[model samples]
Target: MTVTTPSIAVADPVFPGRWVGGASLVLGPLLLLTGVLLRLPFDFFFPAQLNAHQHHPDLMTVSYSFASAGWVLLWPGVVLLAARIGERFRELALWGGALTVLGLFARTFHAGVDHLAFQLVAVRGAESATRTVSETYGAFHVFSTLNAAIMGGWLLLAIGAYRSRILGPVRAVGLALASAMPLGVLKGTTPLSVVAAAGLCLALVPLGVAAVRSGPNPRAAAVAGRLLLLIAAGTAMFLFGQAG
Candidate 1:
């Protein structure tokens, strides 16, 4: 008589599946979309004189400023997603997320302050259009610089994830761009606006691929589904801001 051995059953992986359903997956796309939209009427990332090509001040304020606000909500999702993977660089991801959000908040206030400054200069009648252009443009550069620094932190986390294999080869490239964006800030003379916009656009690629590869994370997906409604709400807010 032969003795038969019992077979062992193995459990399937969990977190990778968790990827799709998470809030980060949902908000990441929305953030990308809103950022892209903000870039459309003009390159909002960069500060330039409001020429005829640009929207009126109010509309520009609504589109450009609020888009930054939307990113504030959107970025945390991505950070959290990174953390969920249990990577060693989770803290870096968290810090990067915090920095990005803080930067956006600062930039939003900067936009408001600059708008007021513009109005004051206009009232003075001594305000040369050239002067207004230079001042306004400079302020945007300051905010863009801050944003670039935050991106540097994010890049560090992305590289960490890639080295650990949490993020795939192609996906790592996108994160690399996200990380490098801050270098533009350091240069001072560099065109940070162009770099930031390009970086943000590149960021979408990794996020999108990760969302696909991780499959549907039920929790993340639910968060994403809810976020879609939030985006609708955001759209309403944008419209109201425009109308108001």
Candidate 2:
């Protein structure tokens, strides 16, 4: 007679296992799209963006918040995409993923600047804020070096995807449009931004759905356990956010 034991899986920190990666893939771009759409009515420039934020603080905050959050959450999904691409084209995936992640970090860095600029509008007036930003424009920063990666990485990643056959050519092209997304502080949406977000939806959302479906079965016990863990994690973050 033999006894067999069932396995309980723990997720790695970086990869975060399949379900989270899949959710990130799906949710990140969608949230970004929502943000882009929300800002479409505004002019697409740093100065205009500053004025818009000052006049419509709440809406702009929500817009930028959603967009920033979406981009901030994208690294996990990129990791998953890179992992899949690496199975076939190791070099492409390696370079592409590294650059893409760096670019994502650049955006996170920009979000901090964007927040500062937004605050300046309330304190110093929109013109003063814009003047401040213009004065500091092109100031030296480590992230400045990675600026090209903003567009460059997506293009390479798209090529890698096509070469790996992980994504069809059309979807690959669409994925590449993410390269067109605007960068820098207090940036506003353009047609390219809309296209980029929509393209990402077309490119990644399907893969995300597929990933979730193929991932570990969410049995009742596993689901309950995960829910409790999620609640605990959220609570911890909230509490810590308020702590000394």
Candidate 3:
């Protein structure tokens, strides 16, 4: 009788990415929706937003913080989605993913500016803060060129998702609702913003949940090891950044 060799199990490279990316896809839109709803009571302008911030600092802080974090998380999730689409459809993934990522970055930048404007309300008062922000509102930045990307990206992504059969036609259209959201620093939410956010959640959350569930359950040790490594790396980078 011949002896048979045991087969070795190999790790899937996409596992870790899928886990984090799927979580991101779920959390990003929900967090952003929370932020928008929190700010909905305020008018969509620097003056009103600053006034809201000045009076309700805690509320505004939490709202904007959620928004900024969500923006940061979207790029990774978008990349993950693009990878799936690219497996069958390249052009849609390339343009849709690239432009969407860029647009997310630009929105993150606006979040930073929003923070600064709110701080200005404390330092210089809401009136002065409003005036300052208004005067400098249209100041040139490289991200200005990508403003259209924010809107166009969603449309392309919607089409791509539908064409790739990654999303149903209804869900793809729901995803496209994100294109309706207004962009800029110190702006507040509108009805359209709420709709857009709802659409985003509708389109991505189910897919995100499925993606996360589709992967094999990672070992507890592996999860712990990754957390430790992340903490160590974060500490190292923070120290390095301080030196820089």
Candidate 4:
């Protein structure tokens, strides 16, 4: 009689990238919604003129801060989505992600300038200072460029997602539609733009949920879920701040 040898099980290769994607999915939209809601009182519009930004310094400052935070979350999500779609489309994803990140970086500058310079002008009623800041920054033109990069990047990402089958056709289409939200900036704030922004926020939820369900790392997903809960709590606090 021969003794049988025991078999050892091998684990699947862990993709640490999934964790980044999952986190991005959870945080990006939530942060964006928070940013938008924070500015609701100011009737803020993307790519708004310097004068408009100056008109609502408090709202602008808060909104930009949250929006900048959202973009920071979104950049990683973009890169992870590209990786998830696999090797064939990886280059496209990289290009798009890079452009989007750059755009978001530019937007951060815009927000900082608006928050600080514009707020100062608003508070002190300094027309000369306002002109100096506006001229120095060329704020609206920068915003226009920022919008183009973000929209173009998202459009490419949506196409890649559809092609990769990572996201289903419906969800991919939703992403494409969401990317159009940037176009609203050209029209300034309107009822339609508000609806579009809401739609974009809703569209992001499915992607995040899918990322959570498909995550290879259970521990990472759990951690992301906990973080999302914290975000929800923070959002509630933000709402309370607004109400107060």
| lDDT (tens digit, per residue) of candidate 1 on 152-224 | 5556555655655555555555555544432321011124433544554454434544444544345877879
* Most accurate candidate by TM-score: 2
| Candidate 4 segments whose C-alpha is farther than 4 A from its true place | 1-16, 41-59, 126-130, 137-147, 177-196, 215-244
lDDT of 4: 0.58
Using lDDT as the measure, what is the rank order of every candidate, best first? 2, 3, 4, 1
What overall lDDT goes with each candidate model?
0.47, 0.85, 0.83, 0.58
Per-residue C-alpha lDDT of model 3 across residues 127-179, encoded as one tens digit per residue = 89988988998899988888899889988888888877778777888899988
Off by over 4 Å in 1: 1-47, 52-66, 114-148, 179-244
Compared with the true structure, the alpha-carbon lDDT of candidate 3 equals 0.83
State TM-scores per candidate: 0.51, 0.90, 0.88, 0.64
lDDT of 4 by residue, 1-244 (tens): 5332111111211442555555676677777666666655543433343355557665656665666687667766666665655455777777766766676676566555555655555666546555565465443554666667766776676677666655555556556664555442212344443554555455455565555555355677887998999899999999999998
Tens digits of lDDT, candidate 2, 11-127:
332555668877888999999999999999999989999999888999999999999988988888888887877777898889898999999999999999999999999999999
* Winner on lDDT (2 vs 4): 2
Residue pairs with backbone atoms closer than 3 Å in model 2 (clashes): none
Candidate 4: pairs in clash: none
State the TM-score for model 2.
0.90
